[model samples]
Target: MSASMDIRTKSLSKPVNVAQYLFTRLYQIGIRSVHGLPGDYNLVALDYLPECNLKWVGSVNELNASYAADGYARVKGISALITTFGVGELSAINGIAGAYSEMVPVVHIVGCPSTISQRNGMLLHHTLGNGDFNVFADMSASVSCAVAKLNDPAEVAAQIDHTLRECYIKSRPVYIMLPSDVVEDQVEGARLDTEIDLSIVENEPEREDYVVDLILKTLHSSKKAVVLADACAIRHRAVPELTAFLDKTNLPVFVTPMGKSAVDETKENYGGVYAGDASHPDVKALVEGADVVLAVGGLKSDFNTAGFSYKTSQLNTIDLHSDHCVVRYSEYPGVKMGGVLRKVTERLDMSKLSVQKIAHVGPQAVAEKLEGADQIIDQKWFWPRVSDFLKENDIVVTETGTANFGIWDTKFPKGVTGLNQVLWGSIGWAVGACQGAALGAKDAGSDRRTILFEGDGSFQLTAQEVSTMMRHDLNIILFVLCNDGYTIERFIHGEEAEYNDVVEWKYKELVTVFGGSEQRTKKYRVNNKGELDALLNDQDFNDRKGMRFVEVVMDRMDAPNSLRLTAEASAKNNARRE
Candidate 1:
């Protein structure tokens, strides 16, 4: 039925309040828990959550709440973030921007003053004192893909549907301003019967066919065609199709840093990570030497590409993006990669190609330790050794510091999903993300263990979030690398600089302070490789139950080879006057 018809049938079905309608939409889209804090403006709206079958996840602060929502969205496809008018929304902006940059879908709902007060221009406590109610929404509009001012009862549900649709389809953040008065505004309940369609718009059949034919023809002519998958392929949910393409062609698959663990490293054909100059010698040679590069969902930012040092030409690379596809210099707008990949995989004639090659340089093959393992924890020993502890179907959250760069050295078991702010480079984000992602994994009904590798300096910024995890009794494994300061920043510019240092905190004690007891949560401080190995080998510790925290003390200056190369390149790039 049409929207007009639904409105007419309101008497047949009991009308739902605006908050009820909004919360129902969120619940419908698999947001089991809503993340954010409550305020005077949003307090009334919280009452309707239980009735809508949605759990409220009140965080330590809006910033952490936003970060949690981003993480939740990453695991659960989309998440909802609730905040109050000005201060609350502003605090959450950084996290929202991170989600926007990384293509995580999060609906940011800002509960504002009543519509009457806005028209009267009354100065509110959270306001700028200028009586501009629209200012916060305007500020968030820059980072959000869609903005909805939900005041009118007639348009509220439709506005929410449209905004949420954009959030899911575009895989980015969207803003919804829900006024206090509108919290109880009546809307036709019949609208809830029909679910909102969130299907991506299909590419023009003829154009898609042409693109697929072109890609296959190019592949047929090339002897060395390699699949270079990146962030967008995962973000746009094209992994299944991309996997099929890889399998059909039997081409070697290499992932970018953002696309780490995208392809199963356990696969025989899985090539090592390829990030410009930072790539492994064998992987680098194979990728750069390839006649054709099938670049899928690529977001080649400076850090991701080792300061944009990629030698692969656009002419040699066929970039398959979320919205479009580019073959050499030709751009096909509205031609999505999912359908194109699916078609290409179906029509691909692998028989025409010479020796459908597999990767000889697989990361699955662990080399014997060249250095002694008796020494204290260092980047080289730590990252590779930790890989043995990881299980398949785990959700690993790496902080945007040394942890992010170091994790590249660790090959994940199959189905291990990785979460790191590669493009945004936001520190202190992992703690909150780990919490939400744990909840997201639980909601997904997948028995995926959630593990967090956080740098001490980065963990300090959002330390309070651990309390939220304790309160929820989430099953999590946390690793804090205590290197005394900002290791990533130190390598980038300020090594030994006082400004780069952060005060050392007892990580194990913090978990206790956050309400975790020895009986309930396990906390360990491992200073060396032997201690780490013993802890990992403990059968009780590997149970994947309760909150387990480990603090790893390491040399402040030591970093992964990928980080060292990328940081030096980044430093040189920054220093360039040209």
Candidate 2:
């Protein structure tokens, strides 16, 4: 026998059940829990969760479960979600699509019928009344980077490892379909000892040296240089490297909306968020007026770039991506961003860099007291007050709509992290995401508080997740903005349309309705600015134990200035031309 074949044969060890093999591999990684819903098809596989030393987080629905998993993955580096075929998997597809768009590493496992049933074309309960079992798998391929359907035991281990490796390497979602009978099929357990290759592609030595030298030369020669960091830095786990580069070169740094919290906001060189026309005047001047811009992991989506209003020329910008580096018009493939940054930082002569002293504007100061006796909670007063309430080591999650756009105005403190769905713009994502983020923080041994700023309309969509938080005893302080209806939708197209209105629910009664303990779960309703101010000042409320829910009542027409501007731009874009 050949040497390669002999080595492969010798690696096989004693046989173990397929479920054990799969869950053990997941456990070997950093995943301590699995977020999912139970169905008849996946019930047996669910049984293996506890056996493999993994906690099973039963979410209220598949979509919420997937969202929670996405949130967990963002903090824990990787997470998994298990759902049944057809209906269950399809329901979770939207969340999976969001994960893919945001570059979150999530493993989506679906339980399927037995291979015999699929071969014989037996009618399935979750199917579309058709015998075609491949339909859902095909649909999943659109959103996932890799797909694996385990039909045979001999190939199941290899398939699982391959799909998982792809999920980790690409930092995107991957789909794995496990037939009901195949869950118990025996597979060689020795393969578990062979670590899956999660390494990124290495750059060509000569090409990497040339690109780094060119970037250094351009930066050294530039009179005005700036650094723009975006969401990809966080997605690709390059925060440490980016931080090192920033520490070495004290260039002015500005982050995109999607890249908030990627850098330490307290740093003196950190300017602020840059969103083209929507950016602060100082930030706009530095980013738009720079002679040479080094953009690291920058994503220029329409919303992020303020409808493509960025005026910087590509010829003056050097874009560093996860797998490639673009120096002006020249592209160098396989040049990893983290490595290139490290090299550039090591080789660059700091004495020759830009010495222009740009004054850094700190967060806007909040008004100490409102002027009127009958003070109402409005966007102008609410955001700044909330910004003062935020402290270090807090994970802030904002729901899409007003909260998402409004949060951009709030300056995050040092060690604080911000989470939002900008590209997907999915409503009700933060509620479910809070549950997972809180749990992930606990699992990672961090005492960081998970604070969710949710919308009333968005909260109503996935309100059932509050019970899950109560069940897990997670420490999450939820602030629900009760604006009476869909405020963002009203700004987008329908100002006073009846379709935009949502049924008002008693927000304070949610804990009781969700079967939470009265002593452990605290609920409060704030109607005016004075009431909210008292709550913010109360140390007892801020230092409370267990889950605390607060509903802040506001005018239906009120919204942040940023959202109003973006909505106007969107409306103009949607208008029909003559």
Candidate 3:
């Protein structure tokens, strides 16, 4: 026999069910739970999750399940969601799109019809009336980095490994379609013994060194330099390396809105959250005024940059991205960010760099204090107060509309992880995300508090997921900002339009309606500052386990200052003729 044939023969081992192989692969990659809703096509596949030692988190709907999976992936590095073909997969497409936009890795597994049905061109119930089996996979191809339809047992294991590797290396969602007949097919079990290779391509040594030298030369030449960290830093898991670089240089570091909590805010050199015009005055000046700005893992989306209000010039910036790096107008491709950052830090000569003498005002010091015994819970009062309420290692999930924008001003303690879909701007994302995030936290053995700040209008979109959270008995604190209508829309155009108004449900009663027992659940409705303060100050409420819901009442027109500014900018951008 040839050497290659001998190796192949030796590598082949005992055959195992395809479903077992798939779930075992997911388990090997640290996915403790699979999130999805059961459907006829996928029900049989779901049975193997337990045998593989993976928990099944059944969501109320496919959309919520996808959102939860996205959240779980953000915390756990990667997560999986199983949905039926066509209808179920299409419903969850939006959430998957968000994952793609934000660089979150999620494996979207669609349980397809039997291979016989597809080959014979039989009309499947979930599919379009026509005999097309490839429509949903085509749609998923737009958002996902990899797409694989597993039918042949001989190739299923290799396909699964390839798809998952793409998902990890790209840090984006991947699609897999498993036909019912193929679920139990026999595949080599030894494939699981070989770890999936998820390693990224190494940086070109010469190109990386040239770019690092340019950055160092620029930094030494400039009198003022600043470090700006963004969401991609967190998505790529470059925080530890980025933090070490920041500590080494002691450069004034500021986080973008979507990148909040990327850096240790407690560090002395930490400036503040910078959101272009929405930034605190000092923060805006420090970043915009710098001669050389080093932006690491930067994602300059509209909402993140406050509708493109940033004043920094590209000529003076060094942008370090996941796959490449750009210095001023020059671009260096195939240079990995993590390696470049580590090399730069190791080679940086701190003595040559000038010390910047800028006044660094912490979030608490810059936050506006409540004025004159105002009873209403306004943005100015609420955000700062919540800053004090935040504990270490809490996972804070913010909804798109108000909570997403408002969270920019709130200070996070050390070890805190902030989850927000700023680029997608999907309104109902956080409720489902909170459920998945809580489960991910539990699986990781991190006893961190899972807190969600959701808007009334946004929460109504995916409120059923709260029931899923209750069903699992996951401990979470949900703060429903009960402003009568869509305050964000009002800030953009109509201040009091009927179209923006959402149906008012007794928010506090939702816990009971969602099947949470009163004995295990704690619910509160606070209409004034005094009432809200009492609940926040209560030790029992603060330290209690299980679900706790708080409905905070605010005026319909009330909004955070940052949202107000961004909304106005958005309106102006929409109206521009040129």
Clashing pairs in 1: none
lDDT of each: 0.89, 0.87, 0.89
**Model 1 lDDT-worst window of ten:** 362-371
lDDT of 3: 0.89
Which segments of candidate 2 are over 4 A away from where they belong?
A: 1-12, 365-370, 576-578
TM-scores, each model vs. reference: 0.97, 0.96, 0.96
Q: After superposition, how far is residue 333 of candidate 3 from its true place, in Å?
A: 1.0
* Cα-based RMSD of candidate 3: 3.0
Steric clash pairs (candidate 2): none
lDDT of 1 by residue, 1-578 (tens): 44864564465456888999999999898899999999999999999999999989889999999999999999999999999999899999999999999999999999999999999999779998998999989999999999999977778888988999999999999999999998887877788998889898888999999999999889889888888999999999999998887676668889998998678888777888899998888889989998899999999999899889798988888999998999989999989999999999888776887544555573434434635556788887777777788888889999988888888778888899999899998899999999999989888776578999999999999999999887877889999999999998999988989999999888889888989867669899987777888898899999857799999989999998889999999999988995
What RMSD, rounded to one decimal, does every model reach?
2.6, 3.2, 3.0
